[model samples]
Target: MSPSQTLEDESHPSITAVNRRIQRLSLHLTPLPPFQPSPQLHMLECAKAANKLEVDKASLQCYMRGKNRELQEKVINFFESRPDLQTPVGIPMEEHRELCMRQIVALVRDAKIRPFRYVVDDPAKYFAITEAVGSIDVSLGIKVGVQFSLWGGSVLNLGTKKHRDKYFDGIDNVDYPGCFAMTELHHGSNVQGLQTTATFDPITDEFIIDTPNDGAIKWWIGNAAVHGKFATVFAKLILPTHDSKKVSDMGVHAFIVPIRHLKTHQTLPGIEIQDCGHKIGLNGVDNGALRFRSVRIPRDNLLNRFGDVSRDGKYTSSLPTINKRFAAMLGELVGGRVGLAYSSVGFLKISVTIAVRYSLLRQQFGPPQQPEVSILDYQSQQHKLMPMLASTYAFHFAAQYLVEKYSEMKKTHDEQLVADVHALSAGLKSYITSYTAKSLSTCREACGGHGYAAVNRFGSLRNDHDIFQTFEGDNTVLLQQVAADLLKQYKDKFQGGTLSVTWNYLRESMNTYLSQPNPITARWESTDHLRDPKFQLDAFRYRTSRLLQSVAARLRKHSKTLGSFGAWNRCLNHLLTLAESHIESVILARFIEAVQNCPDASSQAALKLVCDLYALDRIWNDIGTYRNVDYVAPNKAKAIHKLTEYLCFQVRNIAGELIDAFDIPESITRAPIAMQSEAYSQYTHHVGFQ
Candidate 1:
């Protein structure tokens, strides 16, 4: 549901029905939590669908607002018929993406999920949700897991019926969500305090899953309440006849427990669920809580990689340490974080689309003869939006680049390099989302009060996408991960202030820079960067490296005097800043590299502007970095004000052209608040009526 629908419009019975349908919606938002970021399309669908269906609030359960029985059926049937993709193979990711675009477009056209957007709430059962959120789960979970697994995850071939059939039986064809409920209300980061226990009964040959206390309740599980058919519940396995009635070194096990009955829409005995109350954003999702009272399962329910129980209900495992087993379980969630980063790129594209379109059309004062120029003509607007535009472009390329690298690493099983890639991606993901939260809001505000007007898309986008900042592994946590990686590099070079590797890197860097940035000539093959490629390359690399080194050094110094936890917390801010430095450096590398690769001159010119916009944007933010590198003297940053003005002028000329690349359908994009074309057309129509 969206704020646009006039809840006050109850004169008609239909409008009254619509308002009630929305009142039932309950969920939450992010940005302040340890979740993850997501795609732009999710936000766009909400805005467009709210306009299309004419609803109230940002409710994901649009089925609640169906006007007629037929419309409701259309909405429900659309999802019911969709296929589930268990393993993503043979299908091209691009094809999968196109399918999502077409599916949503068709969903809107057919009035399926008529209110729309709410359909994105569940990721397990349907293909689109699977493609979007499930894909992230895999991307992020796999990425993080790969890292965590190396530190500890069990080797289980995933997404295959072979392994799934063993553990995920009986619940087949249920066509609903499954959850991994590991977080207990009493213990978030601490795994030991989880009070849920599974006691073995040798006579019955069953393991009972029960939440012993209120503190043991599973909280914050996505799609848990209404959507989930089964859950992989984590509980301590209590073995009898043997010793301590208390916790053991190797008792926790992941069980495939069925919580909902098939014939009736009632909860099975011993299972309790509650929908989480309203949230700050992500209102479409049915985040929930669950409690188990004497819930029992067969011996096979335990995922036996680390620990298992026999048919006689005897506990048995060769697992070395419970710590390793616990690490393995937690390792499985790393892909979620990676996917959050990737999704952040997708959302960035939406911001760019809106900002660029508005920039092109929302003009004023720049051309007095024109009376009103597009807001993009103003340097302030460009400063606020264009760099972000460049950032989205940067992220788009970076995402593709990393995906390709990830795929390769997976193929080659190059563990060492993959770790570096994971670190880089983690840093990149953390950095991008942190900035994206700010950038998206800035772009939203650049639209003036129209930005706040829900009709224009920003407010809802802001509300729904709130989790990007701190989700999928907290931004701070991931930044520390990056800091840890950087500190390793710093320590490796401990004696290397001695300079052998430094000169080797500096020489290779020079060679690549010189080769990439050939002389800036009018020759057809000679690109602008070719003119003085080294200077441009050095501008990004030297400054970023300098900043990263400085922060890492500061952080490294405290380790000697302070306790580990204290130092980690003390250097938290430094880690975050260094994450930004990596982002700046990576984006710079991506932008300069991509611009040079474009074959067409016009394409090259447009791309070059994006690159410069990115560089200048960062330079403006940390002028000190540039100052330190001598890329610009202290006063030169002020002089570079001319560049922003000039770029704004240039960007204005190209804004319309660039935004067209997003390819948002005119059917969806026809509103004036978006492009102003709709309002203009309305004015024309009113004049005709007069």
Candidate 2:
């Protein structure tokens, strides 16, 4: 049945069940997570809870199972309400995140407080923020806010109110920091290629912005095609066809253009608009194109913060390099990567929360008479869920680092830092969203076929997150950029410092691995390390760091002899693999930190288990750093199996709170598979909503 139909079928029953639940909470339905001790711990804690509460083991087990069912049902109900908002993939994940985020924010505006209950009841806020429905990715817009407020918004605008400025008044519609026009169809990733000419018509003392060809039209601009009424358009400054040569009129420039005639949504005369066509994802944004044909604007409309044209039509700029001017314009895109990186975190949240919760409630194996075993009990399930959990934690750590870098760069206003952050962000952005897309799919699969049901949420998240891998820049392409940056830094190491020492050490390690007796890119096995936390951590740390250095070295060495394009291609070939390994290595490092920092005994044990899983799981990826080595072949199968078992064990311990992070309230997730138990009283019921 459609989700709408499904919800209708269960709505009445759910209301009754909810009412019973409220009454039971007044009595003994189920205790809260933090207070219940074994509330989220499935087996061991539950066994203890039975002893402490003097309750029957069977009854407590039944209660625990039923409450989990209720929570899962809450999640299902959340999806049923937002039917039009199917999670799309490709570039769509970014928009979906944005769309869900905004709606969630809108819900908070009037709430007495930003209640957790609201996110479950109306999740559009979370979902909206994913960047669907619109072509413009709010990720950049968000950074714009971040830079502006440092309070909330990144360099992107935090839509405070409508602005009816001289050139554009309609920009006031959307909330927050905003974006300007820089990307033209011809310009693409190369902004210096822009051909639009914005010339000062001396008599009128107004700038005439014109697109000379279809190729010169601005395309793929997030806010430009819609929502954004005011755009800082880039055009070449040209002296009249009079006394000066092209050089005399030379230099690309930026101007503020009022593209739309606000009230009517009509393009100003000489401005033509068209949708960039249907896209793979990020549909909520009207990713459209804009063209100008002698569009007239007042002389002051030129964005002259860096350069200016006088009323008499004379041109002047404080900076000398036209190349630098071009760089400045493209430089604005720096925040794009930062916002995208943050966005990946939110997408990971929605995905893991759904997968973990569903994993707990949908138990399939057990005796015919006994309660079914939670799917999480199986080893394979842990292999799927735990690594992803570790991944979410890993990226969160990296994202925090990126955010801090962004903060420092914001304060320092260092141009080189901006570019560096930009490159790193681009690389990190690609790594994260792509990995999230991969991991979310894995999460979907780990839950068995039930993961495909729309009501289950995985299929939705998987599809929705599909676009994240390719949107901002194609994942492989972005990674190639990262690889290039790595090579550049490698070359710059002659200046030597502590980091130089590390890099040199890394170079030697890669050389050692490549010099292995047999290095044929064999798969890795972690059998011996499966039970040994230190071994697993050390092995992963050593191998991953080695692989990254090797990949970076190959690109750098090739550049000196080959032409630039060939050099880039040489690096590009290894980039995707390098990015994957880099992300995994980074994740492992953070996982180790979590293990070391865990204050509680159980928590430390739990983190150690996660570390083992993370390390052992990617064994082969680690060993690939070693050249084709036949020596490690005999133990491969054994290691894979042991790692698999470890994964299962870890899942058994932490499946409950994993589900809680989905933030789905007990009041919601009511589909059939998500049902609670039948053990409850007339005063208190158990069973998923269905």
Candidate 3:
């Protein structure tokens, strides 16, 4: 056969089968009790198809939707096609967990879910795939995330070629289930204080890994209870001394340790694993606690990309400082934070879709002798949900930007780039997850009693996503890290003499504005001035710069009396505010850039409205910050309020269209109210009070 014909012949069957399956699943996955398309939904779909109101599904979805639309659709279709993957309302915890793990394994076996495995063409695709699966089932998403991003990721990123040669293929195929053993019973975010120890032994040329105290036990380890055979363990490495003992000052390192016997599926010698019991949500993940008692692993088990110990007990590393080495090691896993943030966005999108659609269809109070109006028509409902809808878009584009940065850093491994990625990821992760948690909760409340039902999916989304704010580094701690980085940037501008564009671009760009007389003064006269993207950018930049300056001054003043830590503690509230503003500015800038690059005029126009709402709402929320800096007069503050309400009203009309642009599948939405139904009486009588 000719080359082209041969390629076509190879591709035809798989493509045809996928299409056939999707076609078949669509019929099966349609809402039960039957649903009729609402007029608004019909118009939304028509507009999307015509590109008159497209929202760049690739950007929103964070996958190569253009190139991988088939894969994306197939993944969604596969889940909708499988009832086994769906959790029963009140099943036994163990049974629920078993099914969850099984479903996760099924996804791992699917070709569409394979993009989440390591070494994909694009890192964003990894995040995109996880988010898509998560939108349907939070349990499966967490289970797969634990297996792939956390466990497989630690091995792939931290371990050497020898480790990869032995483990990657098995991990990729799930022949060996693994857990990331980082958080301890006593220490979660404070990795440096973890009590687990790996002591080097010259005589045996091995590392003795131990959880000496109860506090040292690995806690919240997904896959460790019953499925995992191995773990990438993080422990303080104790260097062997000539005085017949090992000391722990050497620093922390990651090691490959066997936790369970593969053939028997039981705890290995010197290891004990116990289930973490049940949780409010994501119980399907089988989170477990692991304790090690002098487990022996070979010297080569150390993942020594940044540091290593010789057989003779000498410690060596290319990086001089423990902090630098630690930063580099953790930076390799920032992908986890990025993934969590995007997954939270998925939850946000799903929640808002259910809430808004329900609001439009389910009506409540209205005038006497008048038809009951949709709850969405009420301004209160708009205030509660519209801004959240805007934020979902902001996070979508911001996540894409972070994914692009992560992909670039993975290729280059530049030190400055790594630092910037760590800082930005830390900030964005905290911002996205924190906002998503609040947004999800708001969505639930907006939907009234019906949202509390397990079937609605919002309750589970809220419960499952709650962990996001606490894990992958606590949001509060991560925000502090962002503040610290900003403080460093402020110092670097004077001390280092040169700065990278990522952290320092604002510094350079603001010089012109900072030098002008009354640079932040907002003229409240014209709509063109108020809504101009440039004006919005300037307002945000001014707010962030002023906050940073004020915090720096406070810190410096306090440091004279208190120690550095005490000084920082004294000004922490201000510092946190500065960090929050800085993160908001970063998101706004990235969202604007994405909007500018959009090729379609209609999409741009619609997206610009969402983008404007995001910016204005943030500014309106921080009016006190603007007032403190004299950036806006009282009249301008009122103008900001009026503009925000007006923007929300404009965006509200296209809210359904915007949700459609997210391309959420009805099967995943899992809420009947979100789907259109001609039997309004039936819905009002039955599902209304659930």
- For lDDT, the strongest prediction is 3
Model 1 ranges with Cα > 4 A deviation:
1-163, 166-174, 186-205, 235-241, 245-247, 251-253, 305-332, 366-370, 409-413, 492-540, 543-557, 628-632, 635-641, 667-671, 675-679, 682-690
Candidate with more favorable, higher TM-score: 2 or 3 = 3
- Steric collisions counted per model: 40, 92, 0
Record all residue pairs in model 3 with backbone atoms less than 3 Å apart, i.e. clashing.
none
RMSD per model, one decimal: 18.7, 16.6, 16.1
Please give the CA lDDT of all the candidate structures: 0.54, 0.53, 0.79
Name the best candidate (by TM-score).
3
Cα deviation at 165, candidate 3, in Å, is 0.2
Per-model TM against the reference: 0.68, 0.67, 0.88
Off by over 4 Å in 3: 1-69, 110-112, 119-121, 245-248, 512-521, 678-690
Order by lDDT, highest first: 3, 1, 2
Tell me the deviation in Å of residue 666 in model 3.
Answer: 0.3
CA displacement after TM-score superposition, residue 280 of candidate 1 (Å): 2.6
